[model samples]
Target: MADTARRTDDLLAGLPVPGARSPGQGERAAGAKNTARAARSRFMAAHGEEVYDRLTDGRTRHLRLRELVDAAAREFPGLVPDAAQLAQESARPQADKDGREIDQGIFFSRLLGSPLAGPHLMDAMLRPTDRALRLLPDFRRTGFADLGSVTLERRGSAAHLTMCRPDCLNAEDNEQVEAMETAVDLALLDPAVHVGLLRGGEMTHPRYRGRRVFSAGINLKSLHAGRISLVDFLLRRELGYIAKLMRGVLVDHETSWQSRTIEKPWVAAVDTFAIGGGMQLLMVFDRVIAGSDAYLSLPAAQEGIVPGAGNFRLGRLAGGRISRQVVLWGRRLWASEPDARLLIDEVVDPAAVGAAADAALERLDSPAVVTNRRVLNLAEEPPEAFRAYLAEFSLQQALRLYSEDVIGKVGRFSAGCAAPPA
Candidate 1:
């Protein structure tokens, strides 16, 4: 493992950083690329394929992937650039810094794009994390689990997974991502739970005090402070709980040739608003119930980052033109608007959201709901398409995370000079 790790580090280190070279460095860049390719060939000759095959085989594949990540992290501490480093790098004027994140992103990108490892990587991602598994038994027994930034409660046939983070208006950070995935795992793993429901907890923010606000998106405050990571937060999120919500947990080490997910239908209740990442999530839900006055937006354009899966999925939900308007032009959709109807299935008064959610859950908890959902998902967005999207998304998002525009936008948002789209 140590030898494999060392060789892997050398391969990654030799790869030329994307979008970093000056205009005059084309020749040098080509030379570097050739050198990196040769290094990769050498690494493969030195047992790269054997390492991947051994690590991603059988029932313990996911655990082995975890071990590989840990080993890589230890070998190259900067392999997972923490939020602070990201923020500092973002503040720089040029997007020329060849930070470790770029290399790490390339490493994972190549891995995911590889035929031998891509399917196994997807399976590992779909499987619940060790922490989530650890908390499952307790949650299943008690029907309630509090995962710091998120909570789960089993109510009749429904497992309600609520996002908390009142201090940040339910904004997502690394901690929130972990907790949310764990809660999602619990909701799907519980045998008694036939349906899963998601909502935001009440916020303490002055504007929305004592009221549920679905999500303010990617926690700009944390991003500005440099608390998020490329792998742990960004890649883990899109591949982790978010994917789980769409495809559910993989029950075995079976190949990707067959569908064997233990998935349940999910309904999201949009209380106040769903912004950025929050809106990205609604694309995967079976049903979305929103308050009449609630709104949704994907301000990825303004934020200078790609909204997770929104680019690929939103177009299918809201049409290509509207999707471009929302993702590229930062258009906001009010729940009561006709344009919003494409995304929201039901719109109710704010006070009636609880009743409406309960009713929706009851309706969704049918014997064939999961089967129907699987059929619909397979037709609309197959697993292969999703896998390919992420293979590219991983690299694109990593580049955007450290761009100068993104840093400036985050800084302005953090300083309260810019407001979320109206």
Candidate 2:
């Protein structure tokens, strides 16, 4: 673990900072606007000219993103692609002989794989989209890349933040998280947006088709390949995005202070499952509208990594004993389970999830949700508990990142998401 902690320092030192905006760069965003290819070209010029040549060179048609990443990995060991806005903006989608278009997903895969992209990805995900920042809420999706995956469209006083990647069971990679964080903040900042309905899109998989899976957790393929770094995982997740959720406080030896004042009511519509980090996120919601068939768990113990903020949040929501069974014993809690039921405000049929969530939102006075949540935090949230837990979770998880324990379980764990129950 000591050695692992040391490696984290050396590894992250090379990663790019996520949300920094260079004054001079906006001047460059103009030339790249013509096409994705041009955006990608200029981006590469600013970041890696050699990479640009190899990608654009006639040797490789660069059809699928996976192929590009595989080729880049083979050619440049530990090479990090420049997916900066400069690159992303200038990039134009390319199709192979098959006519399948290539998007930023390739450079994104490599960037996520590098671990350098984590901080930037995390920070970028939390900020409002540039267009969203500059323009009105009505025009948020104007030119955003991530909105295609998890869209945030305004719906009557509430912003509907839906997870749209059914193929991956709504699993979050840097891309999804970035999209989610941006969407979340958009709702938080918008004056008209009083409530948020967090939900998932229809699944197309045979076993789960037409069903909405809340989220399968972090993208496991990226995890299996070790593209996501530990600090990046802990910071963006446990301590960063998830932590900034409410007005909870972070007390220390010196002083106690509120985490972040900017907050709004978030009501998660759990149509199916909220496993792993998906379940971890539930603690921050004002209310959870789970489907009757919904299942929940924090399988970090099984996955060989300490669960993120789930440890603290779950313990707070469901009690310490139940959370321990989960964080330690890999206990799977169904919606009907006593421990699970305690946290779930309401459980309705799958078909009624939409109505139930909106109904719940309608039942509450939006401003009151925020006020009452603060009241609940005062009563339930222990001083320095979350901060202390994440401190430990991040350090130990960093160790788990390089541990044989995780490497062995990742294949089984990741594949299990799409598999039918035995």
Which prediction has the highest lDDT against the true structure?
Answer: 1
Q: How close is candidate 1 to the true structure, as a TM-score?
A: 0.82
TM-score of each: 0.82, 0.64
The TM-score leader among the candidates is 1
Candidate 1 lDDT trough over 10 residues, lowest sum: 91-100
Candidate 2, 142-165: lDDT as tens digits: 322247678777767777888898
| Candidate 2 TM-score to native | 0.64
Clashing pairs in 1: 83-226, 83-227, 83-228, 84-226
lDDT of each: 0.76, 0.57
Q: After superposition, how far is residue 302 of candidate 1 from its true place, in Å?
A: 0.4
